[model samples]
Target: MNPALRLPAAAVRTAGAVSPRLGAAVAMPMFAHVAKPRPVSDDDAPTMSLARGRTIRIPGIDRRGVDVAVYEWGRGPRTVVLSHGWLGRASQFSALVRELVAEGCRVVAFDAPAHGGSGGRRTYLPDWLATYAELQQRYGGFDAMVGHSFGGLATLVATAGEVEAARAVTIAAPADVDELFRGFQRMLGHSDAVSAGLRERFAARYFPGDPDPFSWLSTVRRPLPAGAPLLVVHDEGDRVVPFGESGRIAAANPGAAVLPTTGLGHNRILAADVVLDAVVEFVTAEVARHPVSPTTEAAAPLTSRAEPVGVS
Candidate 1:
């Protein structure tokens, strides 16, 4: 824990000594915190503006409706859903949106609650799952779903026999949902009691009837749709989520392709030309191909099956 947060960690520990539930009640709010808002980058501004007239009003964590900014491009038969990671926005997939559109795919990407232009302050995996549920209903079925980091895990959970999607791809996603909570506990330097309480209360609130919260929340526990091709992309050098996570996901979902890159870390991998190529290719593998324009062919994925992430 940071020196500044040590005091709070101690206080939570003291509270846990009395009752883990009590400590968790106090820690839940912080656990669901969203990072400081990030301005849409200049490169992504144009794509960001595309969501101006397209937005979804979904219930927030409190049940109050909130407007989530959604960006759409193209009008092809295949509809691909893009999910940005925690603290990430829709425009982060600008490069991907362009490619999928060029491949004649109707691209749909949204800013989750409490992130980017979406409303609210705190959000969790369930919040993201709910948003996707709403979209799945509206879209009827999705041809492909691509997500980064936290969004990656949520993507699989949402699509596991719930949403109708043909294929899935994840970038820098964590393997075990339980490990995510455990990692959070480590980050906050919480005591065992406080950490246990956090899971107990969280499970009670979000996963009623499921004694073990992550047993259902996990992708491994609920593998992707059978025969649904999955592409797991991860950078070996990622510090946020380990590279081994992709291995775990691949191992659980046999025949799943594992594309390992280096140096792109977590967020930056989203826009890498190689990552985009693998995703678009896998997403559109079944559909009849579209001809690439001269410009696109000229700038083909800079990295081969061997090289790493790029297009920065």
Candidate 2:
């Protein structure tokens, strides 16, 4: 059977089950596969194995440790951290990393808990945020941070006064978690009852007090910190995440710069020279305008290169 055809068939099978209990049981695992990410591809191996990088493990929410694959390049004073989206690894930012490094800035990027060289099979929004916090703790605050797709949203949430950064850039990011859930539900052709049940289970497990996880995680509801500048870049023809989502982010962060690209879609936007140049320009300008205080700038410099290390 065609892979695309299998999901709808499974949804029908689960929805047609005689007992709701049976339906929920059957449906939950399918949803988990959708939410959980797969490893990076063979084609991405060479880039993922980029030299001068190190991997480390950090304790995440609930004290469950997650391995984070990190790549560091350049030796400039300012440090920029990069975060990749769902199913995305650190090396996806290879182009941007080079650009930032050439601009005389240190660049750091990491694979999320369950993606790339990281450990575990399941990950959540909190895990992504926790990973950022752990990275900040180790490397100190960032001069600028860039996140792509879901990573972009995670960056926004993590940097909400929790982690400090001079400026932030979000690329092809979804503005609302609710909308993401809705899209997932639609993709699986889940019925209303099934969708409601899934929501209940998710909320109970991930967010006990919050009835609406979507609204709770919405970037618009929790705006970025005051005086922190943001840049939102989205492709006009992006099929994965609607361009309107970027608009929502820009509206929420009135000071944010919304840069719309023409041909580059979701992932390609990362490699586009125009996009990379824009990012470097934005960060450089922002850093100069709002320089990190001497205290914030006192953190020790990152090692230019290191062998990847795993935490016990």
Candidate 3:
């Protein structure tokens, strides 16, 4: 723990001692909060400038509408959808965008509500999932879906349902909601009771009338679409999300491939040429083998040029 964050962590523990629900209340805001949104970097500017920008308003959190900022590149029939992580904008995918476009693929990416040029201040997983649903409807599905960190989980959740794509990719993504909740609990130094209460509130708010909210949110429980090939790109030295998470994701879905890199940490992995190349090659393999069309019906199995091995 950072020396600076210890005092606040202690305060959360004290609050939990007072009442579990109250402690949960204290942590919910931060857990659901989106930190300061990252602006487009200088390296990302040229690609972002080339994207045709637009907004699409959808039903959002807290009983409001969220105007999602959507960005697109290329006009090819082979479409790829990009999802940026929490506190990240679509611009983080600049390098990958250029690669996909150069291969004759159309790319669509969005700033989830409250991130980038979108609407609102706070956002959650449901909002991210909703954005995916909305974009899929408008664009008539995709050839591949790529997401980083939080967005990686979102892409997984999207594949579990109706968001049809020929292939999927996740970069440094957590495997389950429980790991994320536990990490948050550790950060706040909250008790088990507080953790339970937080889930209680989370379920009631986002998944009312549903039992086992976490089941719907877990990638293991609802593995990726059966036929679609999945590439789990994770850095061996990632600090933000554990490297082994990709292992979990791969295990849950048989035939998934792993692309392990070094020294990229969490965020830097997004800008790495190796990562971009692997992702583009994996994402476009379906197109090279078959047509760009991705139907709900089963298609040919996904085969990737990347090795299916992991880091030690």
Candidate 4:
């Protein structure tokens, strides 16, 4: 592939969104081909446990008596906020957080409303996006963000407006809104119209706007800011989300780099050595160039063994 066709580190750091229960339609063939069985629960899974961090209530912008959980750790000048995939909690990113904290970076993660320790019925894209905005107000600006699945999609939308993070990493995220919904519909044995209606109901009940319903891949219609970088990682063998979705984001964003791995599908990719290393290196290089603060120390260099293969 031409280097110009690749996504950049800054842009990759800020991509992706999460999805709901693994659709049977997408899971059967996909996971069977490349993904390991997911742990029964995220907290019980070894890859996602970070030493328990502090969780605080962040105000919700649109509702009354609502709050979001923010998990905070370390005291480094640079901060990384983690957003988990569907049904995942802030703690699912423990391994990544632990690694970054050890490198002198601060981290924050959230249990989207209805998941993990947060409140509400299961959430959709809008509320999560609002919660994202509200959380930014409380936590202040971050050096970068890492979002998986739905969270990745939310982060991309959130970044487009008031969110201030400069870098992001999106993992195994779906690209097109219609495709994602269709995938869910097929798994649930619902008609296209029925699925569309349910989606509208979910969005209206949980959020404020008519769902754009476009894929995140479609959302990236322009290149990332010349100064910002993005990294998109996916598994060609992923069963839950098509690898081509990630390709959409890479193709749309002028310099964003895409890394399609052989294994480590979906959830497991969160802790895959290459994934972690790629995230660390992307954030580290940007922090070095931008330098969150002159006094902030970076985490130790990630070893080559952990770096994503064939990624610049």
RMSD of each: 10.4, 7.0, 7.1, 13.6
lDDT of 3 by residue, 55-90 (tens): 887666654676889999999988899998878899
Residue range 107-196, candidate 4, lDDT tens digits: 877776666666654344555556555666766776887888867766665554345677877788765455565655444343444444
Q: Per-residue lDDT tens digits of candidate 2, residues 1-312?
A: 548748664764566355554555566555545234455556555555654667677654335676777778888988898998877878788788777888998888887766777777666666666666667787787888899998888777655536678899999998866666565656656566666676565566655554454553567886676567899999999977889999999888878899999899989999898899899999887453243333431132111111111110
Candidate 1 off by > 4 Å:
1-7, 10-26, 287-312
Which ranges in model 3 have alpha carbons more than 4 Å from their true place?
287-312
Evaluated at residue 115, the lDDT of candidate 1 is 85
**C-alpha lDDT of candidate 1 relative to the true structure:** 0.74
Best first by lDDT, ranked: 3, 1, 2, 4
Ranking by TM-score: 3, 1, 2, 4
Clashes of 1: 0
Residue 99's lDDT in candidate 3: 89
Clashes of 2: 0
Best by TM-score: 3
**Greater-lDDT candidate between 1 and 4:** 1
Best by lDDT: 3
Poorest lDDT segment (10 consecutive residues) of candidate 3: 303-312
Clashing pairs in 1: none
